[model samples]
Target chain A: MDDGAPAGNAGRTRPGPTTARTRARVGRLVTRAGLELAALLRATGPYATHDPTGSRAATRGLPAGSAAPPPVPQARLALVVATAGALHGAVMGSFAGPLGALYSAAKIPLLLGLAPLVCVPSFRVVHAVLGLADDEPAARRAVLCSQATLALTLLALSPLLVVAYASSSRYHVAKLVNVGVFALAALAGQLTLARHYRPLLRKDRRHRLALVVWPTLHLFVALQLAYALRPFVGNPRFPTEFLRSDWMGNVYLDLLWSLRATLG
Target chain B: MPAFLDLDRLLRGESTRPETLREGRVDLSAPRLVLATLVCGAVFGLCLGLFAATGETSDGAWQLLSSALKVPLLFLLTLLVTFPSLYVFATLAGSRLTLLPTLRLLVGAVAVNGAVLASFGPVVAFFTLFTTSYPFIVLLDVAFFVLSGAVSLGFLSRAVGVLFGDAAQGGSQGRAKLVFRTWLLIYGVVGAQMGWLLRPFVGNPAMEFVLFRHRRDSTIFEALANLLRDLGDGWR
Candidate 1:
């Protein structure tokens, strides 16, 4: 411990040519990944200027298809939802144990994916009824993109959950922490959605009505699903089951009970 | 399917455009609008009935059937009760819309209302599946009805404005617009009472499932106030 060489100098001396090459390769891979992630982050943000038709390619004197990235496919966005959702789910259930973690990892993606799918039919109807049927595809992409943003934001905030769990053993505090994380993530997703909807809104004022309808439907469904798939932060008083036995119970009723308990 | 397309066209404001209204008719098929309304009302009713169905009451199935049947009746009967007065006032105010065209326009508005309500069906059913609180569901349903009613009335109001205000060229048309506006209030009052008269839409968990509750002494407004107070009291 006492014989400390300079960190950078020591590493330089230890590596042979192959090791150095390997390290360089790894470094390049990491840099590439970092750039890709940064691009994704920028795309989701409101401030980023996106030209989906590859006009930037011509402007830069490159062939149109060569420089412009294709619009993110639904399959890839779904994959992002799955991967990022699983990561956040892992953190949420880390306080419980391995089995709980696995269960949560499986459920979070479903929560993200299914909630919107259930509401899409009605959303489509609303759009068609409002004479915005032609804009439905773009609107759907906006919804999916926002969901992906939500998942990524939740993943980014998972570290805070880890830290809170590390610092506190209180189960209720753990619940509050998770709730706080989710609320922040939801706000981020909503902002991204609104940003995505801005062009559509500019095209027609009725998109504003759709903007109101989507969240009302999504949140109402999501809340119940979240309640049903409970025990995310397992209580020490109970065994760590994937779902509580009374999983069919209502969130509104539980909330009332909690309020009464607190008041009494 | 064709009827649904017709309903869709009506929803797009195509049927109620200023030019279309100026032609002296709402461009909609009466049978199609009625059919769409029935399907949509039944869909919303099925969602409303989920509370009782999930409550483990012995008469849950019966409640479901009754609710499904009553919802269509609710709108149609409300229209029937309110239409005569609206017609009298509209004629008195010198609207050119004949009996059939006027009825068709009202039916189209109801179809819009039903469609909006049915769109909200999934939300209600989701809550009903999990929620044990009767007062909360009652309040939620009321809120949704208010929202859907507002939307439908907005559609009707716009059509009336086009028919009587923008299209027609006289001061008498302004009077026609006022008559329709006055009728909206009467429609709301009658609709609320009709809903009250057809009680047990969302069956109370504590009570046995009945087709209808005994006529309560209080008005719908008083009952709603009580529910609000009870809900605020933390009935748990």
Candidate 2:
């Protein structure tokens, strides 16, 4: 967890060593970073394609470049989200989660910027994956996903972010941010792809396998990606109520922290 | 010519005079819900702005611009989100209950939530002055604002469709499919429109509101003090 690619480029700086937890976080980060890197591999899964130049400027909705980049937007988003997560893990390992501190009402900056911005890059993928048939629906879904993602993620990360900001207590705000970042990335990307597959079962429409197989595979792949990296996530040690509450809140590590640290 | 919620008599209009609910009532058909939603949108903007302004640039000139403008920004944000947010919230919370009461409940919830979260943003910022620390509190505040509003809106979304079928028309909602199609429309179109309309007026500045100094505390305090100095209603 702690060693996870040093989030914001810990490679050059090199995060310090071991406390089983930090190591776990690092492992996850490293694996995720590896997966992201792997996606760009010449012959591989999600990151298989590569188009340096545009195939006549992506007339329809495709980008100028090929799918080769594996969606830089998603990757970039994952980068920021993951880095934030890494920062959070480091905090947790250092101080443990806190209940309250200064400016306790401030929203999670890492997340606020991360989720929406990241979505921007993958907006098309998500919209298509979700079930966008018409251009209106496409744009509409894109907007909804961003706004909804903002509101929901904000709601979801609230307690934990609050607990984190309020205390000098090293809660795993960074790690939480990463998990959130990835979960969102995977879901956003995969869900969009799923929608792409919807029209497929009948006939392979506009896209060949890009529409059907890619999204379908991506769903499993995203989950697998998240799961593969799960080993590195840290328990931010939040309060019980908050910990037990919310979909994202009830995960393994957070559950541990909430039960132990939370006043309620 | 939409309906409004006036659970209490204070807000006057063509009243049904339902004695049991509260004192006075107003036009249930007024566009108050819409207004409230817009205001909520504004508040969301405010909370977002304040969140952005957390750990700002140390430049005095920039600080001057930011410090001077927070309350107004918050005020505007609260204002903009008023109507849409109201509609959204009313839709979320009391899905089972009728419209007026639903809006009333939503209104009350936001008033409390906005005031608390808004006030709290600065206080948290104040205390956590040292670290460019995580804006955890702001995050919570955002949650408070969103969840409270969302719960209410989620509940009422269906009601919106049922009660104001016209308003709810066009948006798709298949269980096996997507939802809040209209939600997407309004936010994107409206948000974009609002952004466009306000952009020219808003001094093409970067939307760099989140800095981390807890401007909400001092700025809010200053605004209150200014209001007091003006004896509540001074000129422009």
Fraction of true contacts retained by every candidate, in order, equals 0.00, 0.00
Best by lDDT: 1
Clashes of 1: 0
Candidate 1, B1-236: lDDT as tens digits: 76687778888877677886876666676667889999999999999988988887888888888889888888887887677546544643545565556777888888999999999999999998777899999999999988998999999898888887664455667777887888787677777777887877888878887887845334578899999999989855
Best by TM-score: 1
Of candidate 2 chain B, the 10-residue stretch with the lowest lDDT total is B196-205
Task: Write one digit per residue (lDDT tens) for candidate 2, span A191-253.
Answer: 333332333322324444334443354343334333333333234454322122233432446
Query: Candidate 1 — which pairs collide?
Result: none
The Cα error of candidate 2 at residue A10, in Å, is: 58
My TM-score estimates for the predictions, one after another, are 0.46, 0.26
- Candidate 1 has a TM-score of 0.46
- Model number with the top DockQ: 2
Native-referenced DockQ of model 2? 0.01
Query: Compared with the true structure, what per-residue lDDT tens digits does model 2 show for residues B1-236?
Result: 12123212212312323342232121232234334444434444443333234445333334334433443343244334433333322223212223234334334333333333344445434543443323343334334544544443443343334333433333322310123334433333333223222221111123343323332112222433553555434333
